[model samples]
Structures are given as structure tokens and as C-alpha cells.
Target: MRRRAGVGAIQKHRLEQEKYKEKGTEIQENQFQQMSKQLEVFRENLEDFASKHKSEIRAENALNHMVREGLAWVDSQEPKETLYWFPSMFAECVSA
Candidate 1:
């Protein structure tokens, strides 16, 4: 009788262990799914940001090129009046 009871206890312990393992696996799977969703959201946000800023970056580059060309032209001109006019104009352009 004692031996039978011992066998039953051992079986119960094994069943409990299996249940615990199953619960742990389920929890890990849920966490992985949540993390995967979060990662996808981050990826989409990054793409959106890049798309939005791309045009702004191009506009800024074009403006910088124009400014450089203007400076080069000013430098090539005679320094007397061009020098006086360019500084104030450049300052206004920069401040604007």
C-alpha cells in the first residue's frame, strides 16, 4: 500500500512539473509576440520619419547650394560696393 501511495505521489509531482513547464513556455511565447509587434511598430515609425524628412533635407541642400553660388558670385565682383552690400544682405538672408 505504501509503495502504491509513493508511486501516486511521484506521478502527481511529474504532472505538476509538466504543467509548470507548459505555463512557462506559453508565457515566453506571448512575450515574444509582443516584442515582435513592438519591433514592427518601430520599423514603421522609422520609415515614416525618413520619408517625411527626405524632402526637407533636399530643400535644405538646394538652399545651401544657392547660398554658396551667391557667395562665389559676390566674391568675384569688385569689392567696393559689393562688399558693403553683400554683408548686410547676407546677414539678412541668414537671419531670415
Candidate 2:
């Protein structure tokens, strides 16, 4: 009788654990879906912003001026650890 009770308790615990694990998986899937929706909206906004700025980006003289200014700022930077992550993240954004 005692051995049977122990087996019953173990079975109950496994059933509870399985139920909770399923709930957790459902919650994670919901969160993932929500995040995907948000990212889709963000991508749409980015596309709109880029389209609105297309001509400004292609204006050669102004583009050259901006590039020169950017280079000058880069030349004056005190080197630190930040350059590593920012560029890689930018690369990821570009690829994505």
C-alpha cells in the first residue's frame, strides 16, 4: 500500500509538471507572436521614413558634406570599446 501511494504521488507530480510546461510554452508562443507583430509595424515605419528621405540621401553635394563631417567626427573620437558592437549591430541591421 505504501509503495502504491508513492507511485501515485510521483504520477501526480509529473502530470502537474507537464501541465505547467505546456502553459509556459503557450505563453512563450504568444509573446513571440506579439513581438513579430511589433517588428512588422516597425519595419513598415522604417520603409516609409526611408522613402520620404530618398531624395535627400541622393543629393551628391549635401551627401559629400555629411560624409566629410562624419569622418571628421570619427577622426576625433577617443577610442573605446563601443565601436565593436555598434558596427556589428549595424551590419546585422543592413543584412536583415
Q: What is the C-alpha RMSD of each candidate to the true structure, in Å?
A: 12.2, 13.8
Model 1 alpha-carbon drift over 4 Å, by segment: 1-5, 55-96
Model 2 lDDT tens row, 1-96: 344558888999999999999999999999999999999999999999889988876764554665566531223254663121124446678999
lDDT of each: 0.76, 0.71
Candidate 1 CA-lDDT value? 0.76
Locate the minimum summed-lDDT window of 10 residues in model 2.
80-89
| Candidate number with greatest lDDT | 1
Model 2 residue 19 distance off true place after TM-score fit, in angstroms: 0.9
Q: Pick the candidate with the highest TM-score.
A: 2
Model 1 TM-score relative to the real fold = 0.51
